[model samples]
Target: MIKVKRVYDAPESDDGVRILIDRLWPRGVKKDLVDIWMKDIAPSDELRKWFNHEPEKWEEFKHKYMEELRSNPKVKVLIEVIRRSENVTFLYATKSPYNNAVVLKEYIESLLTK
Candidate 1:
């Protein structure tokens, strides 16, 4: 199974292997805190800038981000690894609890789960 977690959340063995999906490391966070660092799966710099997390642009962001994810073969393999694992957690550092990781989590679940 796959789970999504935030950087500020408590890390426990039950949460599974944690992978940080941001293109850049979250500011002020320690390297040792995250388990697998998967920058390859993150949205490209151009797509990330285009989304910008503006409320008015969220729908478009979702669409574009999904497209970005779909086109990347490397990301597909990452998703496959997570699916093959007994459990894995996608850890991100966005302050808004419903931002990048949330969307990506939903997308991943849809693809990897029934």
Candidate 2:
């Protein structure tokens, strides 16, 4: 199963593989908490800045972010991790529930279905 979680949230036993999906290290989070830090899987700086977590831009952001994921070689690594684990939690620092990790989880699910 795939899950999306706040990087600051307490680690849970069911969080099989914790992957930090943000381009930047979240403030106050220890590196040890995450099993993998997939910086390349995060949205490009240009896209991130443009979206700015605006609710109105969410649909566009998901479309553009998924485009980036399709071209990213790092996606193979993420898929491999997911396949090898019972559960994977995508961690992000964003306060919004509709952040990059949520989009990434959705994108990854679609790829896995195919």
Candidate 3:
């Protein structure tokens, strides 16, 4: 199973194999709280800066982000981890709940189903 969560939210016991999919560390969050930090799997700096979490650009951002994920070697590593784990939770620092994590979760699920 795959789940999405905000990095600012308190960690839950059931949040298995928590993976922080952000290029930068979330301010005020401690390192010990996160299980894994996959910066490579996150969107590139240029794409992230361009999107800026704007709802109007969400569709384009998802398209661009998906392209990034497809080309990134770390995505295969993430997929292997997901395949080995029973549950996986992708954590992001963005205030927008509909941001990259949402897209990534859907993308990963698509790969899993195939």
Candidate 4:
């Protein structure tokens, strides 16, 4: 199973194999708290800057980000991790719940179902 969570949230036992999916480290979050930091799997710097968590740009951002994920080799690594673990949690720093973590979780889940 794949889950999305905030980087600031306290770690839980059920949150197996927590992976940090943001391109940059979240402010005030310590390194030890995260299990894996898949920066390469995150959206490109240009895309992230363009989105800026603007609700109006969410749809466009999802489209563009999905395009990026389609070509990203690191996505295979994420898939492998998910395959090896019973549960996986993707952690992100964004205040918006509809950010990259949500998109990534959906994308990964789609792949798993297929």
Give lDDT per model, in order: 0.78, 0.95, 0.90, 0.91
Which candidate tops lDDT?
2
lDDT of 2 by residue, 18-105 (tens): 9999999999999899999999999999999999999999999999999999999999999999999999999999899779999999
lDDT of 3: 0.90
lDDT of 4: 0.91
Superior by lDDT: candidate 1 or candidate 3: 3
Instruction: Kindly list the per-residue Cα lDDT of model 4 for residues 1-114, writing each as its tens digit.
Output: 888899999999999998999999999999999999999989899999989999999999999999999999998999999999999999999888669998998788888899
Error of 3 at 47 (Å): 0.4
lDDT of 3 by residue, 1-72 (tens): 888999889888788999999999999999988999998888889999999988899899999999888888
Q: How many backbone clashes does candidate 4 have?
A: 0
TM-score of each: 0.85, 0.98, 0.96, 0.97
Model 4 CA lDDT for position 80: 94
**lDDT score, candidate 3, position 66:** 94
Superposed by TM-score, candidate 1 places the C-alpha of residue 6 at a distance from the truth, in angstroms, of: 1.5
Ranking by lDDT: 2, 4, 3, 1
In model 1, the clashing pairs are: none
Tens digit of lDDT per residue, candidate 1, span 1-114? 777878778898887777898888888888888877888778889877877777787888788788887887866777767867888888887775546677788788888666
Count of steric clashes across candidates, in order: 0, 0, 0, 0
